[model samples]
Target: MDQIKLTMKELKAFIILWSTQSISTLGSSMTNFALIILSYQRYESALVTAMLSVCTYVPYVIMSIFAGAISDRWNKKYIMLASDSFAAFCTVFVWILLRNDRLEIWHLYALNALNGLMNTIQQPAADVTTSLLIPEKHYQKASGMRSFSNSLVNIVTPMIASTLLALTNIQTVILLDLITFVIAFLALLFFIKIPEIQKEKTTQETVLQSAKNGLKYMKQNRGILDLILFLAAINFTASMYNAALPAMILSKETGGEVALGVINMVTGISMLVGSIMVSLSPTPMSRVKVILNTLLLSMSTENFFLAFGNTLPIWCVGAVLGWIGIPIMNANMDVLFRSYIPLPMQGRIYSARNTLQFFTIPIGYFLGGVLVDRVFEPFMAIQPAQGVFVMFFGTGKGSGAAFLFFVLGVLGVVTCLVFRKDKNIRQLEQ
Candidate 1:
């Protein structure tokens, strides 16, 4: 494929797309945070909290394969519109139920499942469309702007959700989310004008043949294959971190709803900074290096802190300090990924990427829950009135098993090493 450059009009189109997504992303984030908090309050277990997550992600695994093939072959615009509208409609319906105080955990499970399915369609479609609308040279700029927008939204959304959860009902936030999707849908329908790519086809080809072609192409692209593997490792470590952090809070020493929200607020702030840096960087390659460095430091430090569970303030401070690495890594990859893939095949490749990346999340969540409960929590409970588990380093009691923090850091560093050694990855930077 020949490289194309963006026109002035196209840049405006990208802005419109970005604005619309910005609103919808806020709703999505609010709902996600609210539900997790609700589940946490009700269940007090990581597994149940993660079950909501599993419902959200598993559908992506199931839908991505077919969605990818269809993404390559379908009218991409309609795909975006349809998925966005479905998501918006679902938000409204769920809001109505929650507002009536009729919503249940199972309802969250089902609605999140629906959310996941819609995302399977929307994510790939928007990414593919970005490539189609913007030229290759501007992909990095587009990525920067997009990440910046995302960080801006994250910075506010969590803080907003926390305040909303405290001051008003969660139902109010859900209602606001409904309005955001409506605005986003209108922007795509009216403002963005991307020309569709129609691949020339053989008269006798079947859907099966086209699907085979994408898979075969993937098998041959060793560079992409390796990058995906390294990404998966990073994702797995993050998943483990996700499962453990919450358990660390309820570990009997440093516990509170406000503290959990505080950590997220910190994470969002750091991510905003990371996104700004990535957006302003001289090149995408430089941004990737920043991402790797931030992760290494954050993972190493956060674990060290999670190990220091003497008080809520101590754990809270540790939580905020350690969380900065996450958004940087996420923003870096979001830019890098969008820069590389073509519009048509994005769905399949992205879906495949999601499958590999998340395959370990369920395992990690379950393991973290069991380890904390059956292994870590019980042991720590006996060691001190506050400890959750005992280890040679000391005890994770009260704050000791925050030892899992160290474990997460170790896993992340190993994955980073794998990424560093790959020559094909170096080539991508160029």
Candidate 2:
């Protein structure tokens, strides 16, 4: 394969796009941290937090197929602009409710649903646009840039929000998010021009038919489909961890707002470290190898520490090591997926791929909450009933969540081992 090098113009365009998106992400992360704090203050239930996760993620599974199909048929720039605009509007509305002191739990859920829908549309469009603007040789680098931005947001947002909340309010944090969205949308409208992807078939197909075609395309691509299914399972386990982590930390004796901030700071820094490593290094010869190794190592290390480590310092180490693998794994896997899919089909196929990969996320989120609140917490509370779990995870408020994390980590390791045995997955790059 000949490497496609990006020209100066393309590089300039990517820089502008990346800068604007990073600004927006930073603002959004602040608001996300603020909301998590707000929801915990009001509900004080792990189940509620998990439900919020579901509200945020379920829309992708619901709308990504349609959004992907629409993106393929339209100018991706306009799709992104529209999505950003709607998200900004939603933020303003939420701010208004907060100002009036009339904000409710349902309001947050509704806003999350709307935001998720907009993101579902924007995500595929943005990713496909990145692929279009950059040369094939630069996908991993671009992914690294994305990872860095995400890490920056995660690293700073929690600390910022914690301080801001002490001094101001959620309304102020949301207002900042709105401002960032405006900057991003304006940048897209004036500074950047995403070239329209040219498809061989000029005649437009019906929306449903186009979506059906995307599904059909995947059906014929058995290797890709199988890989997607495997990812879906991985996502399910990952979601459980995501849902449980906050509860575990917040409920533990050693954890508080400060501890949470520290954990997030370390996690972000670790991810940034991984992203920088990938960005600075030459692209891997085998993306599949990079992907599997990182996934197995990160998941195993993270869960093991959370399960066995009792103190904040010990857990923080685990958090950092576990997070470091994510960006490396993701950057490589993204390159693999991008290389396999044709550009024109990327919108549809990427959407379809994401829809499947995240299909089990809602279930994981819901179950994480229910199991933690109803099953695990109670089961671990009884001293005599502690059994083998006490030996591994100890007995206390967070013990249940720790046990759950252990199981998920072990499952993630098993998943990587299972995938290694599959011929299609092993040869995906070839």
lDDT of 1 by residue, 229-344 (tens): 77667666667677777666654544566666666666666666666665566664465566567666766666666665555566556655665555556656766676566555
Q: How well does model 2 score by local distance difference test?
A: 0.84
Report lDDT per candidate.
0.68, 0.84
For model 1 the local lDDT of residue 376 reads 58
List the candidates' TM-scores in order. Answer: 0.86, 0.95
**Runs in model 1 lying further than 4 Å from the true structure:** 1-10, 202-211, 250-255, 284-294, 309-343, 384-401, 427-430
| Residue 422 lDDT (model 2) | 74
